[model samples]
Structures are given as structure tokens and as C-alpha cells.
Target: MSTAAVVRYWLACDFHRERRIRAVLSSFHTAGGQLQPGIVDHLAGRRINQIKPSQPNKPYSAAEWERLAQACNTMIKSANTDHRRAVEASERGMESSDASLSEERLAWIIRSSGPLAIRSLMELFPTATVETHQLVVSLRRSLFPDQDVAFAYNLLFAIRTGIVPDGIDALLTGDVTRTGPSSILLSYMKGRTGKESLVLSRAAVRVLDQWLEHSALLRGHAGDQGSQLWLGTNQRTKEGGRTIFTTPRTQYRRRVWAQRAGLIDDDGGRLQIHGGRVRATFHHLKDRSAWTGRTTIDPNHSAKVEADHYLSSHTPAQKDAIEGIIEDAQTDIRRKAAPPLVTNERDAAKFAQQFPNLVQEAELDLPAVQKLLDAEQDVFVAACASPMKSPYAPVGKLCPARPWVCLLCPLAVFTARHLPNLLGLKEYFSAQAAQLPLPQFMGVFGPYAARLDEEILPRFSTWEIAAAAGNHQTLPLTLEEQGCY
Candidate 1:
């Protein structure tokens, strides 16, 4: 098989081919760099293909990703500090005996502990020369800092945004554009949508920005490294403008960092960095773009290819999300899923009476909908004039009670789209009530609690509610989200 095809097959099955091959050959030993079983005859009748690949599962959780990032960053800070102090001591005209660090100790520190341990060793023995400490610190920092942080940031970005490892290294300053909105644009190779403009979330943007600053500092000493995104002690050639990490070193560094951060599985195997990130990107897009029927994470890949290679794993949330989507799709299949174009009052009333469960998808010239909104119903907006106090009150008149009280009020116009938002409000109030004293809970959530129980949820079937939640982004923003809180 071709190398890329082999990789895809391994990822599809979540297996390690090399390890499986080793297991198959455990009984054989090599002599003079050849298998002892006489390879020609052994392969003639061997059914070597019978060995099945083992299925593996090792994706990092959000908490685990954060831990690895923090761990990597902490080492980076310590390593940089050690370099600065040693350089400073050299500049101060201190003799070699005044500040000492041995090559053996430096090697051990770099291999096992961080810069702090090296500093502790230096302090333990004040007999070595300053020149020795300076040289050791400089060499260690040069080799370690760039690889340490570059791998961490690259892996984290890949996990969150689904940037391929090659794509991460291919990034340039101009590629990180913020044309509008909170997200920054990330242009990468082989885009499905003609060099598609991908976006990094606000959080990912912050980390990338930090890495950019550090990369600039490293560039001061990174001779001939060119403008490649990841810079180490390695030099770049003028023709290709590539660093040593352009090959397999990036993956090697990723393994090192993953091991250091305790991200290895209980089986002592590291997760598939590229495949894991791609899977995460698939699910994140599914979650944020639920209103859209399809996820567009890998636009270049066919749907069948995506299912086979990328979207092979599932989390509990993902399964629930898929089930919700299926239920919504089934509802769309059953109900008259199109809007009734009834501009006049008579037809509007007729449509409303016949399909009380359905809502309009297209805008009509009807005065009520026009007065309430000029655009499509992405979210439910209301002019509240309740006697109860509510988070929604600041949008209009005050409410004397909780927000769900507006559901029962005549001034509040609700569609099936409001179902998910209402259900979310119900859960929020329930949780709040759980922590309060009885009387306080009653005072806080008593009416709203009863309203959700006695009035709201029973009005529609659970399937109908689920369908409405997926109805083209119809849920309204909470008061806090709308700047009311």
C-alpha cells in the first residue's frame, strides 16, 4: 500500500501497524540482519495477513489538554530563566568557579527535570567555572526551548481547530488575520473550499499570539531559520525555506511532550495526535453548527471519506447530539417543513389554526411579524411588559417574577423555536433552587418552577421540542448574553 493509504487505514482502525507486525514476528529472531526462519520459504505459505489490528482509543479530554499546555509552558518559562541568568553571570565577569554547571548534570536535567533542577545543581557545587555554566546553559536552551513550546502549541491548536501538523508549520504572520468578529482566519493547504478561510476560536487565538511573541524572541538567535513558523536551533536552506522539523521531528517532539505531560494512556501508548485533533475538530463543528444540518470541518473530503477516516469515534455528547439530529430530521420529514406564504390576515389565521405546532420559516408581509422582526427568526425576541422582575425585563418593562413567567403572559409571543431556550431556563432555575433554603428557593424559583411543570413542557411533545431546537438557530440569547444582566 502507498504510505498515505497505509496511514489512513491505520487511523481508520485506530491501530499501530508496526506494533502489530512485531507481535506477529515475536517468535522470529534476527541473525546477520536476517530473519532466522528462512524468509523465502516462510513467506511462500505464510498467512501473515490473518493478524487483525487492535482497536485503540486515546483522545485527550479538555482538562487533559489544558494540563499539558500548562505543563509545557511552565517548562518553557523555567528554561528561558535559566538561560538569562547564565548569560547574565557571564556578562558580570564572574569566574568559572563562581557559577558552575557540568555537561553531565546539564544533560540529565534536560533529559528528566526542567531548568530549575539544573539551577539547583549549579548552586549545590560552586566550584565549576562561569564559562562552563554559560556554555552549558546556552547549548541546552538552544536545543530545548523551541522544540518544547512549538510542539505544545502546535498540538493544542490542532486539537482545538483541526489544523493539520503541516498546516501549523506552514502558517505565516499574514495568515493570522482578524478581518471581523472574535475569530481569526487560518489559511492552510488543500482547502476543500478553494483555499478555505478557516477560523481559530478566541481562546486559540490568544495562545497563538503568545507563541508568536516567543517565536520572535527565538528568531534573534535562530540563524538562517527563515520565516518558517516553527523555529528551533536548526537552520533553514535558502531554496526551500524549511527547517529540520519539516520532516518527522515534529511528531517526535509531540511524543516527548505528551509523555512529559502524562498524556499517555494506561496501556503506555500515546494518542494519535493528528487523528485525535481531526476528530475533535469534527465534534466541535458539529456542536457549534448544530443548526446547520451538515458539519463542514473537512470540506475537501467526501462525506463517506469523512465517516470512514475522521468521524470514526463518538463521545456521549456526540451520540446524544446525533440522536437529537436524527429526531429533528424525522420530524422534518413528517411535518409540512416549509413556511406558508400567507400575507393576509385571513390566510395567516387559517394556517395558524391548522398547523398550530408549526411556525413560519420565510418572512411574510404580515404586520405582526414585521413589527416584531425585520429579518429571519434566528432567535426569539420579545417586548416584555410584565409585572414580574426578570432578566429579560431590561429589554422592556420590568417583571415581578422570574423569566419563565413571561411564557404565560399574552405579551410574550413564542414559537416552537423558543422551546430549547425555555428548557435551558428551566434547568438553570432548577439548579439554582437546589442550593437554596426551602423558603428562599420558593421565593426565587417557585412560580417559574411550577410554570415549567404545569404549563410549558406539556404544551409540546419532546420530539417537537427537539426538532424546534435544531430549527435553523432559533434559540434566543439569555439576558446575560444580550448584555441585560
Candidate 2:
């Protein structure tokens, strides 16, 4: 059994143990044999936390996958070319009896009279010099390849569609439903997932078409015997026996094909081709193509599985990119969590004592603090410590941020002097709240509005708020502000 099955079996055993414990506890209670409260709780809550095993198979490297794909393509192309030529030559009415034992005559005989028994080929060409086995093998290969060719089609299909080998093995002619001129909806049974369907890509569709055409002659000859989509002649048939078209179900045949292809691993050893690893490689390449600013996990996988199996095994560049994203997120959280600097006092010494780090970070001296208090460095809504040093804009550039952005900015300082403008901005927010939907207003302006009311305004006295409200002017909003709402 697989590792997953073993884990599940142990978990079931744990459950059965817990059930038996419950039964024993109930019998004890009936007999008036009291148990300790802690023991009873522990028995009732007993569970086995099974740690799932990590997937052992890793995807092929990009270069390795490309090499395998190119090899498959070459074999497929050669097979198709030979099949087409054989069919065209047969159409020219080339008589097999008129020619001697040659490649062209063998092709004509196979295409015209179906795959012949070796005894029949000997009867037709009685004086042939070549060995009977060699002749039959060469003719069958040119027309439709041996059962081992199924491996090439299966591998290419898995590489293109990310389907498991079991799914490809289970395919039938009826399972393919054409949705468009160049697309098909292929339905197959996965051993683990049961029945599933996928709309194949154009490239996958092309590969399927080629396989179907290449196997069509054998499929026709086999009739009902060739129900499986992957049909090829059995190469090991007894001498003088008819060619047998059947599905290639054995892994030995696939391994033989891999050996012929000379696939190699990173360590210069023979590549052990696993269906699951092929699927993983497809998903990996897909993820690389679809990657935006963040990691995009496959929807078919659980978040934990995606992270543990795929995301954990990254290249150095990918690791660096992920680290950068994490650092940016942590920095943003810290910046947003810092308390706003609001004070009514004009004493620069007291301000410096209250926010020594901020004063040093922004390089604000006593004269600069005094200037800030006197409204010499005022923005639309707050007194900016440094107008040209906004975090939202480049250093030494005037801030191009919206007025509401100042409410949460680290350099912004609120005092009684800026209260009238603050009250006016609050009024503007209220107007916007009325005009916009609740969700939209919350998404667009909720954080700034909350910071202004809950963190900045509450610091001032009630009389000061009243005085500011009385002196506040109702400034008209710009079209830029009104347009978005």
C-alpha cells in the first residue's frame, strides 16, 4: 500500500481505540467504578495526528524536460511520415507479388492486406534472403510501430495535460469529445480522483490527433479488440503468427522505450520517468508563466500541499523573490502600526523627547520643529515635517499623494493650527460616504477616515474641536475627487 493509505489505516486504528475506550468507560460508570476527571477527558479527546509524508518525486529540470519532449517529437514525426508514405504508396496500386522481398513491397503488402502473419510473408516471398523475423519486424515498424511506441504518446500526453498515467491508460475512443475544430474535451478515470475531464490545449489536441492517425490502421484491423485508444502491434509474437494489436499496459515496455531514447538525469544516470513527476513539471512551467507579483498555487492542490511540495523546492532566484515579498509585507505592517504624531504643545524640546527616533530619522532640529508648529511646512490637511521627503514619493520630490494619504503618513503632525482644514476634510469624507455605496466607501476611504477620527482628532480637547468647527470653511471639492466616487 502507499504511504497515504498506511497513514489513513493508522488513523482508523486510533479511532477504533478511542471508541473502545469510550465503551469501557461507559461500562465502568454503570458498575459505579468512578474514573478521574482528567483521565476521562484524556480518553474522550484521544486522537492520532498523522503527519502526511512528503511527495518523493521531483519534477524534471527545464533542460531535461525539453530534451525528453524533443525526443518524443522526433519519434512521433518519423512514425507519422512513414505511415503517410506507406498509405500513399498503397494507393498507387503497387502489387506486392510483382516485387521481390524489399521495403517498398513490404509496405504495400502491409497497407493493402493488413499486417500479415510471418508464415504468409514467407509463402509470398519464398526465396527471400532476409530472416523472417527481421522482415516482419521492419514492415510492422514502418506501418504502425510496436507496443513500445505507446510510451512516447503517453509521456507526451501527460507532459502536455498534466494528467496521471492511469488517466492516460484508461482512455477510450468514446472518451474524446470534440468541442471545436482544434480542441477536445477528454474524459478519463484517475485511479485516485475517479472520473475527471479536461479541455485539452491545441498542442495537446494536435498530439492526440497524430496518435490517432498513426494507430488508425491497426485499430481498424483489430476492430472491437482495439477498444483502447493506445493500440500497437505486439513485437514478441511467436514466429509465423499474425500481428496482435493491443494496449501497452506494462511498465517494462515503457522502460525499454526510455532506454532507447537515452533519457538522462542530472547526475548522468538513466532517468527514471515517473508519471507524477511529468505532471509536476507541467504545473511548474505553468506557474512560471503565470507568476505575477506573488506565487500562484495550482487550484487543484491544497494550500499546504502546494506550499510544502512545490513552493518549498524553489531555485535560488525564486527563493530571493519570495524573501523580498515577505520583507515588503513586514515593513508595510510596521509602518502602518506606528502611532501618529499629534500634539498641541509648541515646545520643540518636548516634541523631540516624545518622538526622538522620528526627529532623528527625519533630521528635524529645533528650528525645523518650530517651523512645523508655525505652519511653515503645511500640506492640505496636516503640518508635514518634510514635504519633499514623503515615503509615497521619491526622495527630494514634492509629494504627489492624495490629501487623505496625509492622515496616515509618518511625517504628518496634527495640532490645533491644522484643525479647521482637518474638520473640512472630515466633512468631505462624510459627503463621499453619503454618495458612495457602503462597501465601496469602506474599501476606498475607510482606513484614512478611521485613523483621522479614532487616532488623530480624539487627542485634542472638546473645546478645541468646537472652536475649529466654528472657524472651518466649506471648501468645494475638486472634480478629480468627485469623479472616482
Candidate 3:
């Protein structure tokens, strides 16, 4: 694993606890020495495999291995006793509210407390699927331990569907009111919900929320990061380029519901939760994971870069803001290609002569335009709109208005491809959106979007497992990340 992969590796697991562990390690150890089995033993108890020669056909490096070590450190620490107890406590609290306790509950428990929760829940269902009678009995015994509470649930759907935080059971529970999660209401409390909190169903949102809270990010009805959802730079010229920063589907959904749930109106743009872009999220996660590919791909370098650079230090909202930028960067680029640029000096002169009066009135604008063009023949009217600059450079730097950045940006690629599908970003966005009903779209995309946050992207990433944040020692990123040294 490269530095970035190692960071993402820890993120793929218990990113929350791994954050603290990373801090500990960064503050304590400073160098990349040989594989330190003693440290691995002390942290995760997993012995390191001896370094082996790479096959002639295969190439690997020490830096990658060090990254893997950092990620492993996070996983190891998450399983540490302190983290376990914290997760267990969270599971118990969730159980207090979780209605279905058989498989659904079992899923939640196991995912949260890991093998321990599984072992405990397994005792309740000694004979596989628990009928209502068995479920009731198990529930009574499990909930009260000493006495039985008669809580009756409806007839079963699928026992396997419930329990795991991001599992189908959790999803089913989320669809209905009884198991519908109120969300892991968090406000800097740092609830340690654990990975077991992740289930496939609607409960996945709650699980993801709790997972974030566990990472020490404050969550509630509303909060803002006081940051712009864009990443772009202004060149020496008057124009500045921008890359839109978009919130993940999970965070976006949480935001929408947060308002309905009476949490907060506008997190003042700092925090936003929209539940409509899970597919895009999956693609991004896959892209990052593909880099590490440990035992699989090249050991994802991009993910590790993200983990190293923007994994934890920034507020959850800030991190999301950055990820949003990255997500946008990977998005498909689309725009009205400039009308054939003013190809020649003769055409430019003719256009000037035709608009001679308008030109005189807008001298300031003309100078800016002339400055942008290397010569009079350089400009051309494209798309029946204003004359556009060369396509080679990002549109933002070419155009001055901040909103214009969307017209020509690599980050906007995904948005460009999907905007037609989404009523929000489509042409005549407000008008088209007004003509269409939203419930159905929200239903399918809503949950998916909720599933794409850092807490869930791992499902699509290289890890072949759910990913988390905060799992590396060094701030992993290229020199350009503003927050790091």
C-alpha cells in the first residue's frame, strides 16, 4: 500500500477510531522503519508477513507497504478494548429502540460489536430463523434479560434483511415506521455506533450517521462548515476557475430529512445532506479503491492520498466539502461548445464594425475580451451565446463569473451526465423540476445517496468492504491541499 492506500485502508474499516489511533501514532512514531511486528502485535495482534520479493512481472514498493501498515494500524486500534466497549454501549442503546431483534437485531449487533455481537445474537436464534413466537421469546429475554417484555411485531418479511447497519434488514426497517430510524441523532457526542451499525436497508442511513458521529464529527438537524463547496483557482488574470463541491448522497439525504425532522433549516451551506446520488458515489469510491487494490489491485493510491490529505483534520462537513470537490472533479464534463471561435481578424473586424456603438459603450468588457484573445481573429460566437474562449483550458479561468465555472469543468462531468436525470441540475432546472413529481426519484435515489457517504462508499471501493475515514498517520495528499503543510 502507498501512503494514500494505507490511509484509505484504515478508512475502509473503523475510520472514526482509526483517526485517534493515527493521531497517537503520528504524535508518537515518526519514521517508516522495517515492518515492526511488535507494534502490529501491540496494536492489532496481526503478525506482519515477512517481506518477499516481487515477481519479475510484478512491481511493488516499500512506500506502498508503509501505507498498508498505517491503514492496518487503524483497523487494529478500532478492535482495541476501549473502542469495543464504546461500540458495545452504542449497540445497547440502539437495541433499546430497535424493534425487530431476531435476525434484524442480530445483524445490527454483529455489525456493531463484530463477532461478539454476532455471538450474543446467535444465542437468541439457536435454530436459524426465529418465528414470531421465537422472536417474541427472544426479544423478551434479550431486552429484559431477567423479565419478558411483550412487544408484538408484524408478520415477517425476511429475517436476514434486518440487523446489519448497512444490510437489507436495516433498509427494510427504514422503509417502515416501526423500525424507521430517527437517525443516530448526534451533536458532537461522538456516538460509537461501530461497523455493525451498518445494515443494507433504510437503517443504513442511521448507521452511517452514527458512524460519522463516532468519528467525533458533530451531527444534528443542521450544521455548517462555513466553507464554499468549490475548489478552483484564480489565475493572474481577472477570471477564476472553480470546481463545484457537492455533498455526498448520504449526507445530502440526511440534510433533506433533517429539515423535515425539524433538525435545522440550512446548515448555512457548511453541512448539507442530499439523498439522490448513490450511483455517482459508488463510482468515485471504486475509483479510489481501485488504486490500493491490495492483494487485489495496485493497493489504491488515490484513496490513501485522500485519507492522508483530508481524512480527519477537517470538520466532517469540510471533509465532505472536499470530497464533493473530488467527486465533481471526476464527474463528466459537458458544456455548449463555443460557437466557432472568431476564427480570423477579418471576421472580428466585421463583428466590431457591426456592433461599433455597443463596443464603445462596453470598452471595459471589450478590453477584458481582447486581453483573453491572442488576436482579433481568436474569438467566435458559439452556442448562440457569448463568444467563448479556447476549449483546451478549464472554462472557469476562461470566464470570470463564478457560476460560469460549471459550464466548463472536469469536476462537473458527472453532473453534466446526470443533470438531465436529476431535476435539480437539468436545463431550466427550476422550471423542469416544477413540472415533475419528486417522490419516486427520491425513493430510489434517496437511500442510495444516503449510502454513498464515506461511511458507505467502501461497498464500491477497492476494499471489498465498507470504508471509513481517519486511518493514516501523515496528512496524505499532494502539495496542493490547502489544509496540510
Candidates ranked, most accurate by TM-score first: 2, 1, 3
Q: lDDT of candidate 2? A: 0.77
Error of 2 at 465 (Å): 46
lDDT of 1 at 171: 69
> Could you tell me the lDDT of residue 343 within candidate 1?
22
Tens-digit lDDT string for candidate 2 (1-485):
24344336546675555466557765885688776665555445644543456776688998889988987888887777867876675655374455555666666666656666555555665676757457555666767666767668777888899988788887999999998889899999988778999999989999999888888878777767677898777655566665765556466866777788898877898877777788888988898875555444665766678778975799999989999999978876887788888888788888889988779879999999889888889877788998888888889999888888888888888888889988988888898999999999999899999998999899989998898885665554579766865
Candidate with best TM-score: 2
Candidate 1 residue-wise lDDT, 365-466, digit = tens: 345443433223222322331223233245345454334545444344444545656667766666667766789878756765776666556766778767
Q: Candidate 2: minimum summed lDDT over ten consecutive residues — where? A: 1-10
Each prediction's Cα RMSD?
24.3, 15.1, 31.1
Runs of candidate 1 with Cα error greater than 4 angstroms are 1-131, 138-144, 178-183, 191-194, 234-249, 266-272, 275-282, 285-485
Give per-model TM-scores: 0.35, 0.50, 0.14
**Model 3 lDDT on a 0 to 1 scale:** 0.32
Candidate 3 regions exceeding 4 Å error are: 1-270, 293-485
